[model samples]
Target: KEIKDIVPFSLLTLHNEKYNKLQQSGMSQGKMKALLHNQAIGHLLKKIAPNVPEAILIDQFAKEEVYYSYLNKESVVQTENVYFSTKAEGIHLAVAAASILARYAFIKHFDNLSKAAGFKITKGAGAKVDEAAARLIHEKGLECLPAFVKLHFANTEKAKRLVASKYRK
Candidate 1:
């Protein structure tokens, strides 16, 4: 619900546009940009309140990174590097809030995808997940896969094979 409220349709449109541009240009360079964005958001959230504990902020950052990595295979290296440093400062409320928000968003997105696919898809965005997703696509039809899932993931190919084998048997 929070994610649904904060991320408007316009943002989705913008993301789609950027994604298409990246695909067409063969750029695929947003990994760092995404990390920086997460870091900045986390920092900003941590700064919102002086009373918020540094431990909380650090936990939030770590959780957010873990969530993203699990869902997108995107390494949150910056978050890991700053986790201990920010926790020691005890003044990073904004970062903490941002981390929580990031995690919330990831879960919300995964839920949405699962809903679209008409099945409770697990959160691990690894090869096993891809294989499972491919089977879902084959069984339910391609239209079932959510738009947010990166089609370029190698798991997609594995999934395709899984689907083929299912039909063969």
Candidate 2:
């Protein structure tokens, strides 16, 4: 219900294939993921800019401190109107609604990806995640791991090393 009222919202999903190609460009996983998110926000802003009456208000992500200028900063859509207050969701209805929409989209894609990988793909970069990746590599194949996860993730290296060590067994 939090998101249901927020109409005219835009969303973008990044699949593993896209991330694999991005990973080849030698970008760090965190930066690459941030770029994707920044681009998505830019897209949403662009979509609503025209409909906005004078100014478009945006809720800042709690983690977003520095503005990512690599994402078409020179574009006509100005950031002057964007609000970057911490915990803006708690203070603004728009922010709370956007957070809800973002979470819903994330969960939906996670489930879809899990189904495609044929195993429950856990979220985050914990020991369990590394174990899951190693098991996935062993059960599937060395090459198939990319089809299931963001290869740019640093965990991929640990998982790969684990897979290699297991091969000697």
Candidate 3:
């Protein structure tokens, strides 16, 4: 890859304070997702901003709605070189390349996570993932949850309730 740098950080991990803030902020689900994406992309831009890359590009999530609000409501810096569009993947080589790199890093991170956990830590918030997480909580105990799970997720609550009942009576 000819990219200047590819920085990868896990958002929903024990070390990141953003997860706790997100839980307390009570933002709508859509806004919460946007905040997470914004932070991920923002971190990359901030890191490489020192090098002053040729251009920053992205795949637009929605119309005037999300972007406009994000721009106005937040301190998203944009100069002459930034652009956003629906299918930037199709139109802009940089956007497509970044997307691919991000996906590769994401999968690789989880693969290592699964290895460390001694089980296949499934992706996405479905029953299987819930089951795996609940099992981890049961076997490893609640303290270990922060190490591998996004504690703010509703599924965590459900898992906790299930665990409480299982050990109750």
Best by lDDT: 2
Report the alpha-carbon TM-score of model 2 versus the true structure: 0.72
Models, CA RMSD each? 9.1, 3.7, 4.7
Clashing pairs in 1: 42-95, 44-94, 45-93, 45-94, 45-95, 46-92, 46-93, 46-94, 46-95, 47-94
Residue 101 error for model 2, in Å?
1.2
Off by over 4 Å in 3: 1-17, 27-55, 71-74, 79-81, 152-154, 161-169
Ranking by TM-score: 2, 3, 1
**Candidate 2 — worst ten consecutive residues by lDDT sum?**
69-78
Q: Global lDDT of each model?
A: 0.52, 0.68, 0.66
Model 3 RMSD in Å is 4.7
After superposition, candidate 1 runs with Cα above 4 Å error: 1-21, 29-91, 143-148
lDDT of 1 by residue, 91-149 (tens): 56544444556666667766776676677777667766876687677767765443534
How many angstroms is residue 151 displaced in model 2 relative to the true structure, after the best TM-score fit?
Answer: 2.5
Off by over 4 Å in 2: 1-6, 26-50, 57-68, 72-76, 165-169
Estimate candidate 3's alpha-carbon lDDT, on a 0 to 1 scale.
0.66
Model 3 over residues 26-141: C-alpha lDDT tens digits?
A: 75545655555566666766665566667656577755366547456776555356566878899977677767776766777788778867889898887778777777788788
